[model samples]
Target: MEVRLFRRDETDLLQLSIDTLWAKNHVLSRDKQLLNYMFYDNPVSQEIFGEENYGFLGTWLDGRPIGLMGLMAFDLNVKGMKKFGFAPTNWIVPPEYRHTGAGLLLMREMFKWNPSVVLNLGITSNVARMYTGMGGYHVLPDVPRWIGLLQKRKTAEMLLNGDVKFLRFYQEITAVYNQTTYHVERRFDPERWNACYWATFAKRSIGFARGASFINWRYFQHPSFTYQLFTCMDDKGNYQGLMVLRIESILGGQAKIGRLVEFMANDQDSAICLANKVVEIGNENELLFIDFYCFSSISSWGLESVGFKRVLKSESDKLVVPTRFQPIDLETTHMMAALYVSKDVQKKISLIDDQAWYITKGDADQDRPN
Candidate 1:
C-alpha cells in the first residue's frame, strides 16, 4: 500500500470509493460514505496543520485492495517538550483481518517512518490493549471533557436578558484598565506583547494592544489553525472582552469542541449571554461538542450555568513571547482554557490540534519535534 499527502488541486478523496479496511472502525459504523469525505472532511482542520495527511496502509494483493489502515500526527507545540510525540490518531481494521497481524504490520511501518513520534490513542474498548501490545503506552484515562449544550430556550433567554454585540472582521478590544479580573486573574501584559495586536483589541499601540494583535494572529488567522472569534460589548457600546475558539474532538461518534484559547470578559451576565449564543450557533451548524475555558478571566458564570463541565484543568507554566520584540515593562503571566464537543457525528473526525501544527523542522528542528 502507498501513503501519500493530498495537496490541493490533487484528487479529492471524498468520492464513492468503497473501503473494506474502514468498515469495522467506529467512525464507519455511522458514515457509509467515509472514503469519499475523509479527504475533504478536515480542510478547515488541515489548513491549520500542513495537509492533514493519511497513513493509507492498504495491501494490494493481485492488484486488488485487501487490507487498509490510517493514522495522523498531533503536531502541537509544548515549549520545552519539542519531541513530545504524536497521537496515534485514528485506526481501522476489518474484523476478519483482526487476527491476521495486518494491524501490527501497518503500525510498525508508521513508527519506522518516524521514530520520534510517540502515539496517543483514545482509551476506548480493546483498542488501548491493541496499542499496548504493539509497544504503545497508554496515556492515563483523560478526563471526559464536556461542552455545554445550549438548548433553544437557554439561548433565547440569554439573547433576551443578556446583551449581544456584533463584530465585523478586524474589530479591536482595548482593555480599559491594567487590572486583572476576579476569576481569570491574568497578570500585567507580557513584555512587548500587549493587547492591541488583535486588530479589534486596540486602535492605537497602547497598554495591551500589541498582545491582542499577537493573539489574533496566533489563534484566528494563524497558518496552522482554524478558530472562531467572538467579541462582547456592554449596552452602552463599550468594548468588553474577546474570545477565540477552535474545534476539537475527544470521542469516536462525537466531538469534544470548545473554547481552547481566549482572554477574560468584563461582566458576568453578558458573558453568559454570549456563551449561550455561541453554543446555539454551533448547534445550528451541527457542532454540539461545545465548551468554554477552565477559568473565567472573562465570563465565568455563563459557562457554569449552561452545563459547561470542568473535566480537566491546567495552568500555563511558561510564557513564550514573540521573536524580535522588546520586553515590556509590566509583569508577564499566561492562562489557558478548554471545552468539549456536545453532539454530531456525520463526518470524519478532525483531530483538533492537527491544524495548529506549524512549528517547522528546518533550522527550528532542534527546538521541538513531533
Candidate 2:
C-alpha cells in the first residue's frame, strides 16, 4: 500500500474514489442526492480550507485508491494569537481492505503535517475507539439539543413513558422570549465573510477564525444547498446574535427538518431570542422538528427554557434518550475528540474547558447538504 497527499489535479480522481467507495462499500452507502452534493456538486473545499490542507488518500499496490481521509483548515485563536489547525473528516476505508491497516496509515500521514491541533467533531463508535487507541482524546462530545414542533407522536410517546413533566409556569418561560426586543433580518451577501463579521465572534475566549471568504465558500457558494443566515439586533441596532439555518425536505418533501446550523450569541437573553426566532421560522414553514447541537451550558439552559429538550445517545442504542440537563463531559464526548501536537496549543486546551470553545455543526462538514 502507498499513502500520499492529494494533488490539486486529482479532484476528479477524488470524486471517483468517493463515489465508487460509497456505492460499493457494505458498511455505508448513500443515495445519489447525497453523493452528488458531497463530491460532485460542491467543489468548494479547496477555496475554503486552502488547497494545501484538504487531506490525503491511500492506494493499493496497483495505485488504486482504497482509503481516504479529508482535513479542513481552521485559523484558530490560540490564547489571543492566530494559529492554524485542522479538522479531520470523511475517514473511510473499504471493508475488503480493512485488515491491511490503510486507515491507520492515512492517519499517520495526516499527523505528519503537524497541525497545531487535530479536531474530529463527528466520530462514530468504531472510529472513536480507533482514535483513542491512536492517542487521541475525546475532547468534546456532541449532545444535540432538539425542540419538536409537529412531532406529536414522538412527544406523546415520551410523555406516556414518563419522560416529561408539564411545567406549571409555562407563561414565565414564554415571557423571556418577549422581553428581549430584537429585530431579526435575513441576509444574502456574498461578500459577508469580512474581517468585521469575524471580529464580532472573536470576542469569545476561543473559536474558529471565521471570515467572509470562509463563510461564502462554505455556505453561500455551496452548489447543492441553501443556508439562511439570520442576525438579531438590539434596540440600538447592535449585533446580539446570529443563526444559520437550513430546512431539509425529508420523506420526499412531505415533511421538513429545521436545523440550527450555527449559533452565536452575546448573552443568555440573546440566545433565548435566537431560539424563539428559530421556532417561529420553523413553525411558519411547518417543520417536523427543530434540532441543534451545542456544548455551552448557558445556551443549553436558555434553549431548554423555551420548548427545547436535551437528548443524549443511549449506551445500548444510538437512539436518543431524554437525558437530564447538565453540562456534558467534554473529555468523554466522542464527537469532540482532539489531538494536539504543540505544547503551546496543549496549554491553551487545558486553560479552557471544551464548553469555552465556540463550536457548532457548521464548524465541520456535518451540516452540509451531504
Candidate 3:
C-alpha cells in the first residue's frame, strides 16, 4: 500500500471516493458539499492558507484508492503570530480496506508533512485510538454539549420521573435576559471581523487565526445549511461582539434544534448579551432546545446565566445522551481531536488547560455545509 496526498487536479479521485462511500451507505452523502467547500472554493484557503496546492491524504493499494482523508489548512494564532495547521476531516475507508491498515498509512503520511498543529474536530472513537497510539499527540478533553430547555417544567418533570422517550419540549417558557447594557440585532455581515476581533485574538494564548475569509467560508458561503449572524451593540451602537446560530430539524422535522455555533466577545457581559440573544431567538421560534459548545469559562458562565445547562461526558464515550428526560442522538457528539503540538509551538503557547485557548464547532469542519 502506498499513501499519497491528492494533487490539485486529482479532484476526480476524491469525488470517486465520495461516490463510493455514499453508495455503500447513504449517511456519507452529507459530507460531499463540505469536502468540496474545503478543497476547491474556500476563499480564505485560496488566499492565505495555500489550500490549492495542498492535496488531501489518500492511500492506494495496487494503484486503487482504498482509503482517503480530507485535510484542510488554516492559519493558527500562536502568541499573535501566524502559523499553519492541518485539520483532518471525513476519514473514509470501506469495509474491505478497514483491516488493511490503509487509514493508518495515510495518517502517517499526513504527520510527515509537519504542521504546527493537527486539528481533528470530528474524531470517532476508533480514529481517536489510532491517532493517540501514534504518539507525540495529545487528546483534548471532550467538549461538553450544553442544552438550554426553552420550557423546563415538562422536561424537568420527565427527567425526574424517568420518562425520556420524546423530543418535544414545552414552548411557554419566557427567556431570561441579563444583558441590560447591550442590545442585539440580526445581521448578514460575514466580514465583520474588525480590529476588536484581532485584538481579542491577540490576547488569546492559543487558537486558530480567525479572519473574514475564514468566517465567510465556514458559515456564510455554505451551500445547504442556513446560519444566522447576530451582532451585539452598545448604547452608542458600536459592535461589541458577534455570534452565529443555526437551527436543525430532526426526528422527521418533529423537533427543531438550535445551536450557538460561534461567539466572540470583548467581555463576559458581551458574551452574555450574545448568548441571551440566541435564547430569545430560540424562544421566538419555539425551539425544543438551544445549545453551545466551547471550553471557555467566561462563555460557559454567561450561557449558564441565561438558562443553558452545562452537560458533560467522558472522553471515551461515543454517544452523548445530553438529557435523560428526552435522550436523542440527534445532536452530533463532537469529541476533542488528537493534537500534535510541536515543542516549538508549545514554547510559544500553553496547552495545559483547554480553557487557555478559544475553540468552537466552527474551529474545525464540524459546522460546515453538511
| Best-matching candidate per TM-score | 3
In terms of lDDT, model 3 sits at 0.65
For each predicted model, how many residue pairs clash, with residues at least 3 apart or on different chains?
46, 4, 0
Question: Every model's Cα RMSD, please?
Answer: 16.5, 6.1, 4.6
Q: What does candidate 3's lDDT look like per residue over 273-370, in tens digits?
A: 87777777887777767777775553565666676766544444333233222245434555566777777788876545555566667776676433
Candidate 3 wrong stretches, greater than 4 Å: 21-33, 47-55, 92-105, 153-181, 188-192, 235-237, 313-336, 351-354, 368-370
**TM-scores of the candidates in the order shown:** 0.40, 0.74, 0.81
lDDT of each: 0.35, 0.58, 0.65
Report residue 177 deviation for candidate 1 (angstroms): 14
Tens digit per residue, CA lDDT, model 2, 196-236: 34455564545555555556656776666788887667787
